[model samples]
Target: MSESSDLVMPDAADSERAAEAALRPRHLEDFVGQPVVREQLSLVLEAAISRGNVPDHVLLSGPPGLGKTTLSMIIANEVGGSLRLTSGPAIQKPGDLAAVLSSLQEGDILFIDEIHRLARTAEEMLYLAMEDFRVDVMVGKGPGATSIPLPLPPFTVVGATTRAGLLPAPLRDRFGFTGHLEYYDDDELATIVVRNAVKLGADLTQDAANEIASRSRGTPRIANRLLRRVQDWAQVKGNGKLDLSAARAALDVFEVDQRGLDRLDRAVLEAVCVRFGGGPVGLTTLAVSVGEEPETVESVAEPYLVREGFLVRTPRGRAATALTWQHLGMAPPEQSDTLFT
Candidate 1:
């Protein structure tokens, strides 16, 4: 059996990296969608500046490519503070966190990506650092090791995570403001594409931009990537202008269908409807069957599948809906209930 025969989740770090590349908004104004978050973040920054103090810890939770890291940088810029970038996995021990916290200048911003993956010990250290600008360091050797309290510069912690549920309640409560980022709307994504095209000196027409946006999986990063690719195709195939036909041809070559089903997505449904007989199949078995990592199945494939009504999650596992069968060019099982119906 292939290694992916067992369910495996894609590496969270890898997903973060891809999302970061495609979607990290260059500025607060360019960050598309998430209106409520944008408004609230503005208020938070205003409050902090009015008082001339570091704002409360910010917790940003959302799916990948939603501009969490970009927002963190925006916050730092707005607050007139330098930002220190780190990740949960980077702070493996309390001492690692201590070093970061201790080095911060007053009113600095420390952005920790993937905060949910923080080591437990480091999480404990953060409580004190967040509440009080202090780090407790152990002094001396085994015979008389003593905890020494070290003062820290007043700084804001911007915590970004795709999995907020994994954060400890105590750590969660430490954040004074929490921002939940939502996926981009089609219009917002189109706007983002237009904005990026303007920056990149690409000739993207409105209809062409909209067409690419519609298939962007509601992600700015994907929209930007698609625009660049289509720009290349347009320059080579058509004129420099990315018109509708050029955009379509580019998407076709990229394997992103009109409905945005890539090879991985199609492979998922095919495995479900054809192999599992339209599943009520366990996740592990399905993952193993697909030769994909379970985590990838859960995070990437399942989100889109469920969103499109092609799959359903249940206590037993995942079941392919009638939509899945139809999409996969198969007839639904006679005995199965229509998941959408």
Candidate 2:
């Protein structure tokens, strides 16, 4: 079996950073999926622009690779403002956040990715900055310390998080708009694949695009990545064109199954179904059996599995669904119905 980390998971790699940036949609209209979010966000930005004021602080929460960062950039562009990019982990102290906040220009968009991982002190400092457009900067040391109120420009903050539930209520409640991005459907993903292929100057047929979309685990990032791989295969193995055959062969080489289950995905499913008797197994236990971290199982693998109806999370533990047994070509036990129930 391949190592879990080798799987074509949704997490971004350092090498793909430039490619992702290049593929990002410049405007909300160009964004392929999340119709409701695109419309609502358009309204919000337009309303703010009409008033000649900065938009409210926006919060975008969803799984990785769903374009939170891209939307944040779009928000900045639509508002005709500069975007300052940073992450939660980068701001280890309140001073770090204060420096960034104090440097902001009027109508600037501060995009903080992984906002849930922000340090508690930094988070508290952000509340005042977002709400009052000011930061209470402490000067001096010990008992002689004094808070100097620093007024900031009216700016918009676009916060992105994979785990929105981890955010404190104070921070969460400060955002005027919170958009939760859902995974893309196959049709939506297919559209994204075709658009990306055009940008890459690759020959991708509709059937080829559909094949890649179906095996992309319903994520545009994955769909584009798969298309790139298929393009390479087509160039070397056949004519320099991406067709259904080229896509299938390339995906097979990469160990992506018909149902889009990569090696790690299969490992998780197998561990749950075979090792744990179709499991009511705990997530940690299941992760252990598959030689992975519980976070990897939960964030990377399990979301797709559960979304595809191959797995279930019961209060007792993680369990396999009837579809899982069928996918594994196993006849469920007599008590399988009770397990699901």
- TM-score per candidate: 0.89, 0.91
Q: After superposition, how far is residue 186 of candidate 1 from its true place, in Å?
A: 0.4
Q: For candidate 2, lDDT tens digit of each residue in 1-341?
A: 56676665434575578787888899889998998889989999999999999999999999888889899989988899999999999999998998899889999999999999999989989999999999998999999999999999899999999999999999999999999999999999999999989999998999999999999887887888898999999999979889999999999999999999999998988888787788789988988899989998998898889888998888878888888888878877776532664
Candidate 2's TM-score reads 0.91
Provide the lowest-lDDT 10-residue window in model 1.
1-10
Runs in model 2 lying further than 4 Å from the true structure: 1-15, 333-341
lDDT of 1 by residue, 74-122 (tens): 8887888998999999999998998888889999999999999999999
Candidate 2: deviation at residue 133, Å? 1.3
Model 1 bad stretches (over 4 Å): 1-27, 335-341
Q: Give the lowest summed-lDDT range of ten residues in model 2.
A: 6-15
RMSD of 2: 4.8
